[model samples]
Target: MDKIQHQTRPVFPFTAIVGQEEMKLALILNVIDPKIGGVMIMGDRGTGKSTTIRAIADLLPKIEVVSEDLFNSHVSDYDLMSDFVKQQLQEGVSIPSEFIKVPMVDLPLGATEDRLCGTIDIEKALNEGIKTFEPGLLAKANRGILYVDEVNLLDDHLVDILLDSAASGWNTVEREGISVRHPSRFVLVGSGNPEEGELRPQLLDRFGMHAEIRTVKDPSLRVQIVEQRSKFDSDPYSCIEEFQDTQKQLKDAIIFAQSRLHDVTIDYDLKVKISQICSILNVDGLRGDIVINRAAKAFAAYNDKHEVMIEDIKQVIILCLRHRLRKDPLDTIDSGTKVSQVVNDILG
Candidate 1:
């Protein structure tokens, strides 16, 4: 039998993408701090959600990963060992190291549970009669991003699988007298149109930030977007030069932000005020406070500032905590209205 090789897929360059600055910014901020969690993009179809995510692969810097490790586990100076690896070390075997590029794996809506998680490799296990573990999408996405389109429409069982793997940062499989666990940490990126169906609140809260995108309304900008896309579709490489320059600028900014993030501090009084706002708005859970704090810090870092101000917090409050706010029972009140009321009460 001839061995089939995996094909390299092309991604649209981030810089080449048309307007959607808010969505782009949110994703970049999350990348800067995966502790900020993941980003959820809700928007209309053809609004460039998938395109923006794919483009990120080209825009961001490459990461170092363990060669042949299904999950692209990073080998850092700290050398924090995963449970599986710790056991291996305890057994007195030297672990090998080889560097490979990071990956961005897409999880399609129709993906089966067995495929998302791994099933017994029937061919290797039964046909060849060997006990071998086969990795899945979760493993491939480690130290990288996992993008899901139409996430709201995904099967509940698959969603449960994703949520479990995400929280644990590892994928464990036990079947056919084989038990294996592997690190599966990765940033989750999901995009869907709200009109289709609502995301389960639990899964929704798992996303660190949310960005809503819409079609560009400006006539000139819209035309320019269409023209640029046309040109790129015609000659991908020729259009990439201009895109590369923009991507370089973004990469440089990210590097700068990473260095400056820790230096950026938050004021005690402002932190108190942020808590008051969340409390007044009755946002559920502690995620609101955590996200607001991280967003403010990221905003300050992005601006090359040393401290987070009320203004910085205000600028990011909606993106960070808007979805978490409890809806007003009165049909007359909208989320924006609630946000504005809180902002005015605090800033006024």
Candidate 2:
């Protein structure tokens, strides 16, 4: 136990992170409502993208899962359980469970589809008449966050496979006609540097929200960030302890927002206006509108409001719509600026 504890790395607290408010907001909104899909964060190197994402994971409240379940099957939610667990439950088996931190899975850039999606043991099936499915990263990420760093450097085919599973909330693997399908519901967070490469336009649109972050240009803020990181590096446990109270507060806020998200209401007029903005921007599909609605409600709930306010929509609209806009080679303005301009014109 001592060795295990020593091997585990301590995380910097989410509340202790400085600057990059937009990126933080995007992640928080997604946590409040995974149906808002997931956030695509594009930023320069060493902007704390990975650190912030990991901190968010560490800061989340624990969830109960079936004991010894490969998929982290939810203790009660049937939809969140894997096929094997569901079968066992249906057969009247009482499952033992334990609480665990929400999983944060990092997808390596070189991971293959089989490695990510798992595989079937056909020989075992033939010999023993038991379908032995090897669980993969997707199985481990169920009801959790699947993070891909430097996502732009990943193969587009693999990215598509991941997006498909994320959108469908399930992953099915087949080998020689023997198949296994499992719940794969997860918030798919992808971060990459534009200096590497850009995801295809169609692929980029699949993400629910896009947040852009930059290196701190202000000297004082940069110094502060550096100092904070230095402190964390020197003594991670003490640094995390220093912000435990704020971390609990933020975690509580997230839990409250998630519980209240469905109860939060949006006005018909607001919906119409959101669609109008999407139309004016010529967003490819209804995804932009839907994401905006979900994200706005999440923002409202996060602020402890039961009714969606324009301010709530304003806070999330750019994140939802920026990446969906058609590329304009001749246009000098960034997509975020264009989104804000349209929102102002329409909402005003």
Candidate 3:
């Protein structure tokens, strides 16, 4: 639709948000480098976990998308496009482009399997006597953010479907004598209160980084947070306008980071340091190293730097490796302290 129609949707301004710095940083890191996988936020309810994520859409710069593409595919980078579509481009067909709003699809807890994975269009199939594929939430979330709140309570089958789509960057359907596959390469974001339930380990591993959010206990900070939120709730439109300049600056920073990400280089010494820490800690899988490297690079890019440094790697290590590391057997040490120890032992 038109710009006015699109702008009607309400979004909380990122700068105006209160507390939850860790949650905000982790989410921004993912945006800077989606290959770091996605961010998982675990916290108590009403800590702004969901609000911070939803506000990300407002902070992001609009992307150039393919005209008439259901998935909002990026015209500039067709990395996730199907082989069939790629072949069409090779055959000299002109691919059109349109500037559209970036997607941020929220998958609710009450959604069903059929609604998640495309179900057979019974009406169309029966009327035409031919199987037709109806797209689902995954399809709608392509090349954007797929947010799942209360993720710990998601049904097992749906969790499997989400994991499969995330792993392969595509969703495949086979039913009623019809088969279809489409790109489903959205960044997976999940937030939930751990007291409700623990996330399945398999699904948990899909998240590249995790952050724990807690209510701010500082009296002055808490008061400021409450007052700001109350005023925004009372006059969201004017409050957002007041914060528009800050939002624009953040949007520019993200755009600049995305452009510089490719040019950013990591030194071999820093890579070795990253590997040494993960190896020393006996962390499983090479994914930790990959995430650490990507997170560091993104951090450097966010700072408008061309080279990754030990400081950047160290800054994000807790968020990057916290969820991946096994629990200490002693149970006496805090995770942050343990992480710091590992960093100090290696980097010092």
The top-ranked prediction according to lDDT is 2
- Cα deviation in Å at residue 39, candidate 3? 0.4
Q: Show where candidate 3 strays beyond 4 Å.
A: 1-6, 82-95, 122-131, 328-330
Off by over 4 Å in 2: 1-7
Score candidate 3 by TM-score against the native: 0.92
Candidate order by lDDT, highest to lowest?
2, 3, 1
Candidate 1 runs further than 4 Å off: 1-10, 77-99, 120-131, 176-178
Candidate 2, residue 205: Cα displacement in angstroms equals: 0.8
Most accurate candidate by TM-score: 2
- Candidate 1, lDDT over the whole model: 0.77
Per-residue lDDT tens digits of candidate 1, residues 158-191?
Answer: 8777867766677888886666677777778889
Model 3 C-alpha lDDT per residue in residues 156-240, reported as the tens digit of each score: 7887888778767888877766677878987789888989987866567678888898888999999998898888788777778
lDDT (Cα atoms) of all candidates against the true structure: 0.77, 0.92, 0.82
Q: Please, what is the TM-score per model?
A: 0.87, 0.97, 0.92
Worst 10-residue lDDT window for candidate 1 reads 1-10
For residues 267-340, what per-residue lDDT tens digits would candidate 2 score against the true structure?
99999999999999999989999999999999999999999989999999999999998888999999999999
> Which of 2 and 3 is ahead in TM-score?
2
Better of 1 and 3 by TM-score: 3
What is the descending TM-score order? 2, 3, 1
